[model samples]
Target: MDGDLRGLLPDDAQTRQEPKLMHPFKNFQLNNAIFAAIWLVFLAAVLVQVYLGAGYSARDKVWMTACVAVFSAFYFWAFGSMESHPSGWSQFSRAMLRWAVLLVIALASVPVIKTGVISYAPYLAAMLGFSVPWRKSLPIVAATGVVGTLAVWFVAPEDLGWSSLVLFATPFLLVAVGVFSQYDVSRYQLQHELDLAQQRENIATDVHDLLGHSLTVINLKSEVARRALHNNAEQAEKELKEIAELSRLALAEVRATVTQMRTPTFAGEVQGARRALETKGITAHLPERLTPAGEHETVFSWCLRELTTNVVRHSGANTCWVSVNADKLQVTDDGSGFSTDTVQNREGGLAGLRERVEAAGGRLIVRREHGLTRVLITMSGDSELMRDGAVVQEASE
Candidate 1:
């Protein structure tokens, strides 16, 4: 059980400390599989045209038939490789290799232009649409257009003129537009993934906060109860009762925190935080309601939990106040004050809170002065601000 718990903990604290890595290929399986299948179908059609009497010479049929088989195999292999690793660059390189090979075959048609392989232009265009990324795909498509035009222009000048270039290049133009559209789709998909990741991080932090403070209070109280047990059984019994009630509240908070990210509103989170703080014997004052909390309720909830947890654990305060206004939510505590400089030197708790606060285009302020330690968190309207930057500010005087 201990081993399992340790394994479940974030890797080294350092690795978990860093930002998550993004996938290079974006949608991976869906996109790759769809494109690969399209390429395979197109190759099959090419094969039919070659062998099923599309007016090809015997040699022309053989080369086109060979190209079709090779293209299909390459599509399957590249798609599988990409599926294996969507994040790393290795699979992308493999996909590129297939594109290069197919391009070479299409370019080779120029030298053997008399072979009547020009009908397979659609297959090459399909590869462009399905395989290459926009930056590379665009240039390659243009090159293919140039080479294909030159192939027909020079190979059989009488039968195929410069005008034939446009006819041969029609498939590639269509494929180019399709590839661009897919790129837009991919961008939107990436944004959605990022939003989901942010939500997960918020949820994980909530779990950590909910359980962490409850356990700390329970431990402290249990110790107090244990010491009292030998001397005063009545006080010991009282403490144990408090522990039981606190445990139940903690369990409820855990459930609430898990569901909080999905169904966050200002009221629910504020109420949960108030209950959590009250159960821990920390006085909490919150707004009746906050206006225009927007879709950023999850972020604000996370900030509230982290600040409150810090108060219970580090601030040593008997009282805490939570205030919500136009764009800022603040937490203030009065306790045995520590040096503002000292708080900056520590990790794990306050720093993480600061990160979470600042990630949402909000700011975090930690100050110790005149027997009070205050943590003020401010969030602007933009959620993207939180995803990019999370700063650690110097504790105040």
Candidate 2:
């Protein structure tokens, strides 16, 4: 009666390739205009030279301005949306082409601006962070840092000549970009795995409960109809109608539960179990009143649904007993016994129930003693949870 829907759909996330995280620089990447405005300050020497006619003709300034404009626009677009771009030859080609463009601009700026290569070295290193994986980018970034540091030492800066701060900062910036980008990628992937695991667990539990109890009830009704067919035609006909209605309702429930996922109410399950047990000629001991369970209500509802289904289908009991305290639910039956094997081996819907309980920080136990079987569940060590009342035992065989 339980443990059947475990094969319906395997988690697709298990086989999925790690999703690429949003561009490592996504958070820090400013708009194109802003990025250019800030970095353009570094071009003060070139702009001053162009204004005063000190170094050369004005044409060099025109070329440098065009290059910076183009680089800033392309760099922002590429880095901000790297994650959305699909992977494969096409993506790699595009990434490489963009990196090459930036490298050309960086090199072209050197002789025109006379700041040496270190003026644009930092930008090139940032391009590497997005251009390739960290493993490849870090090594190249390290090389650029070493080269930049040496160039800064040998060539006097006609551009921003701040000295040692520039020397230490240049290399550190290169490596920092690579590390942070990789860190964002790793963090995003771990969060995705967690979401997938939680989704798989929810589907596993609901599918079993929704299908198992419904089918068991349908089977019980069929048996009732069969037994009454010859001796009581009117009763048999009523049972047939109920069987039809139940089938339709169960089908609807399966579809709805799968579509959005739902939790069944504890009150509804209690009533359902009562009707199911009555059909089996088993007397039921039920709570006289259902005071609110507040936050714990949903889990208690699922536990009752699973417990009643097992009792009606598996236990050959004359009387069914159920008790609820604040932190515990104990269902006892005068049947053969509850099988520990189902739990030990994780056999059926019972196993799904166990998972649901444990996920909510509760544990389930089943024991057999002197021809009576008892199943008890405790949550959060709070024995006062549902301790409002006791069950009113119905007289039985």
Candidate 3:
């Protein structure tokens, strides 16, 4: 029942708090004019078919004209209100009721006038396609086609040929085409929404990883400085300076993370990782630079940042090593090695990192071997890393 009520409202009503004029017609103030023109054309067509095509008594003509007028009015009302209604049961019910009234009137009047009012089938089918679920509309449309064809066959057996078949089939064909176009539009909209959602998730994950690790380090240094202040003056001064430096770095990182447009390069990340590890009293073994022959710098930089963060936050190791090559990058820590269960339960960051790696046509692997917790990322030669690298190099040269 709730669903039915929701379906009676416009599509935008639930999403938009205030009404805004939409494209094509609303922006130009031409919607009413266009609808009026279309209705005029429809009315003219129906009058021509009734007055000229069908031979009837004056009384019957008047009745048929009244019926046509009523049918046209009902059709116009339904079409104009289509965008106001949500695409579900309420819209379908409204369309079906309109179709039912027209079908009954046309069928009943056929015996009196000796004329089958088959011309309106296309317009009725269009209404069904536009309003109802395609699956329901399709079967209904097929049934209409069969009944209309049979009616024509019985009415004039001598004229039971290709013309009758064409008349019956055209409406169904048109309805199918119209419905599929709507389906394509719906698919495009869904894809756009998914893309926007993915972008938001990526931004959130990046921000969390950036702030969480930096803040943890800053807190640890501040605590160390507090303890040293009571025992040793020189050591406390050194710790205090490091705390200030770490705070400044964190502030810069926060700014960069929020901007989202600039990504740290592999070299920059390696340097940053060394400083972070040193502050935590952990040994850092990192390469000076990584020159992989691909465009994958941003993804690699992100992976490096995430791995370094995990090492600082979770690993109790005294030493951390980062190795980068043409095809792969690995971060190893001789920390308290993590079990698969621990990683699954505690490592939400790795899941986001894994998605980023896979999107770049690379794979990320995490394992504990030889008492070392290792996070290895492998990239294919034809991956996004290479493509991005080439684009950057081209732009520079």
Candidate 4:
């Protein structure tokens, strides 16, 4: 789990101690705009109620409008603070205080003014529901409902039975909206995290494959150079120069990997596989060129690299053959063939390749027959071409 966390965080992100500054309108500009528009609509509703509702004089309407303005300001401040300072308890407490003040003012105006000014109580309940956790917000929602009911009862005790229903139902519906809104926000965040994790996995896998192959070849050449240093100066010099060239290529590959522009062609992989096989005292037979266009190139190149690596690391084979065409690639090795258990327990490199191939709308098949292990990969929607006595075993992604 700790390793997963480390992989999820970028190098710079892991090193940073302080919290990064969150831009207010970075990814959520549309959401913020919609929220602001809703607040404006609420404010307009308050003013309209103040002007049209009965039993309120000019002076009472002016005082009610003043309170509504202050309430809107406090609500905006609380909302903005929640976005900016999301972690600390101090900001949460301050926002809660602002909400409490708005509720108090709304409840206090109930006994004095017999107008729709009391409707703001439910809006405060909904805001609290949106801003805080459900456990903390539920009591506030209940209190707002009670306050609204009392205000309705005070204004017209004769109509209290039916009028009070509106007071309770309005806040209840708004609280439901707030809960669903928070749920949607949480779901979006989870999906974003999943995407980030998948991206990191791909990068880590590519870098590991790239470095592992290059370093293995480099180590082999270095050993050869050391062995020939005393007896043959020219051979040792040639090996040393190749090592330097390989190191430069490795560096370029790393840079390209970081920029997400490193695409290993099937031709390049075939050449690399041959060189790697020869270094390990294994003979490799490969085509002169295999030009698979579009997506096939990428999938086949990775399959070649993975198969070659498996041959070197897992198979005790002296001879290996690679065949590639437009739609299919087959790698065969006369190795100590894998048993059913061994294939089932395959992990790391082979497993990663299986996932890559399957995700590209293709199937990966491994077979152990006639003292040879064969790997066959074909793209989806391709015609099935039969090989002599080869039973295809498809791997799941």
lDDT of 1 by residue, 1-397 (tens): 6455656677786455343244333333433444556645644544665567645678876776666566566555455445344343553475566667766665554333343555555555555565556666556666766665676667567756533554446665757776876776566456556755787898898889979999999999999999999999999999999999999999998887777557555555665666566555565656653344556666776777666766667667766766665566666677665566755775545677666666767766666545666666666643221210012221343
Question: Which parts of model 3 have CA positions greater than 4 angstroms off?
Answer: 1-43, 86-91, 108-113, 233-397
Clashes of each: 2, 10, 7, 0
Model 2 residue-pair collision total: 10
Best by lDDT: 4
Give the candidate order by descending TM-score.
Answer: 4, 3, 2, 1
User: lDDT tens digits, residues 256-340, model 3?
Assistant: 7666645565655765686577656566767753344247777888988989988888888777877776677778887886566
Q: Cα RMSD (Å) per model?
A: 22.2, 23.3, 22.0, 21.5
What does candidate 2's lDDT look like per residue over 1-397, in tens digits? 1224433435574334334333344323233224334554564554565556666666887877776767666666666444334343354455556667777777776766554445565666566664466666667666666665566656764433553444347635755765686676566556545644676688778878978998999899899999999999999999999989988998898787676435655555666677677656566777632444557777887898888878888888778877775677878787777568867678855799889888999988877655677778888664332321122232231
State the C-alpha lDDT per candidate. 0.61, 0.65, 0.67, 0.69
lDDT of 4 at 351: 71
Name the runs in model 2 displaced over 4 angstroms.
Answer: 1-41, 44-46, 49-53, 80-94, 130-133, 149-168, 174-193, 261-397
Between candidates 1 and 4, which one is better according to TM-score? 4
Q: How accurate locally is residue 188 in candidate 3, as Cα lDDT from 0 to 100?
A: 50
RMSD of 3: 22.0
TM of each candidate vs. truth = 0.43, 0.47, 0.49, 0.51
Q: Show the lowest summed lDDT stretch of 10 residues, model 3.
A: 24-33
Q: What is the model-wide C-alpha lDDT for candidate 4?
A: 0.69
